[model samples]
Target: MKRIVPLLFLLVAAASLPAEKTAWAFRTGINLTPGLVYNRVWDPGYNGSALTVMSLRQNGGFILGGGIEAGYNYTGFNLHFPLRAGLTVAGGDSLTLSANLDLMPGLILGIPASYFLFALEASMEAVWQVSPCLGISLSAGPRYTVSPGYGEAVSPLEFIDLTVGLAAVMGN
Candidate 1:
């Protein structure tokens, strides 16, 4: 009788413990993101006519395309760091093809919604992510022209970007 009682207690204790809701799952998905970039042009007045000084301005555009991301989730907190590289085709008179690279780290709080996962994303980018994949990304951040004369004359421009997009997961 004593042995049976001990076994029953163990079983009850195990059953009472809460199960883990989040696991280390592999994610590969695509996102269609539309965002803005603020850019500042610095011309040291070294290169003659090619060099021009400009003030900071707000540029608006859209980045339409896809990307692949991998991340992990534990409990209600998720750690996602995704590297997105794509193409950006500018709008209006500044019609130019630009290549962008963005390294994003995001965290989502609260219980994950069914069929839909939402989170607040904050990231720093060296280049626009959609410029390589999609056609265009607005001017919300500093952009260095890939051309030879442009990048060499002015270097290391600082830019802050605000991006909004949707991500879809594929496979397990």
Candidate 2:
């Protein structure tokens, strides 16, 4: 499953390349994501402060790409390598709005041991271009994860996350 995601992303990105001229830019983002986490069987907790480093791509005309994010959450940590695909829903000269979907197959290193966590998140971001190559973005999203509970039952974990991020973008 881990190996399949990257291969699938590459295939999609390659095949979806526009026949006409299109540009692709690499982005490195530093973000602070604060979220509210709720467990099905347990009580709700707000232990969701994370410092994330994400590397994503922005296609010039069509918004589609892949990304990997490594972050340190409150008591646990996660490495989310997802196919971060986005669509430019709205935009202006200084600001651009996008909606994104992330299909993440990642490692959830909870309290004791590491386990598999398949996560899905849908988000909307508004990017304010500080300069030609720099931007500040504000994003809010909801994430759902199918996680292993170790000794407890298997269920989905939910979170509503808000992020403030800065990005450095280059290329077409």
Candidate 3:
């Protein structure tokens, strides 16, 4: 399932590409995403009920500030790559300062479906955005906890999180 997800995403991305080549546009928008996040823990030598712990329910919350996006229009769709960083508030007792670096390769289908857009993105986020001057963005995609060191002492932390939030672009 893990391997297949990426393959499917690529297929969708390729199919969405437009036939006509056009100049890229820098776009900025505000979005709100409300979804579920999954949490997991991995221990190298631990076993017997302590080997792995997981939380796969809707217990996580996220908020995006403002973001900027850049992309080109091909055929009739727009292919975009956006970067967003925000705060993550979990339902659990723990509170984490979270940020994500995501490659949101998506298409904004022309009219009729104009107001709607879709994309598949992969992100690598840290505890916070490096620069405060940079704007925040809103995006949705599969989120994975590649490095699990947040709640190390109490649990081995790892998660496949789904997040929805908004971003504000600064420079643009």
- Please name the candidate that would achieve the greatest lDDT relative to the true structure: 2
| Model 3: lowest-lDDT 10 consecutive positions | 47-56
In model 2, what are the clashing residue pairs, if there are any? none
| Model 2 CA deviation exceeding 4 Å by range | 1-19, 31-33, 41-45, 51-61, 110-113, 149-172
Model 3 TM-score?
0.25
Score every model by TM-score. Answer: 0.22, 0.69, 0.25
Cα lDDT, all candidates = 0.27, 0.61, 0.32
Q: Which is the winner by lDDT between candidate 1 and candidate 3? A: 3
Instruction: Identify the runs in model 3 with alpha carbons over 4 angstroms from their true place.
Output: 1-137, 146-152
State, as a TM-score between 0 and 1, how close model 1 is to the true structure. Answer: 0.22
Report RMSD (Å) for each prediction in the order shown.
21.6, 4.2, 18.3
Q: In terms of TM-score, how similar is model 2 to the real structure? A: 0.69
Q: How much is the lDDT of residue 67 in candidate 2? A: 59
Compose the digit string of candidate 1's lDDT tens values, residues 1-120.
344345434433432333343111111222322223223553222110111111111122322121223222222232233333334344333244434444333233233221112222
Compute the lDDT for candidate 3: 0.32
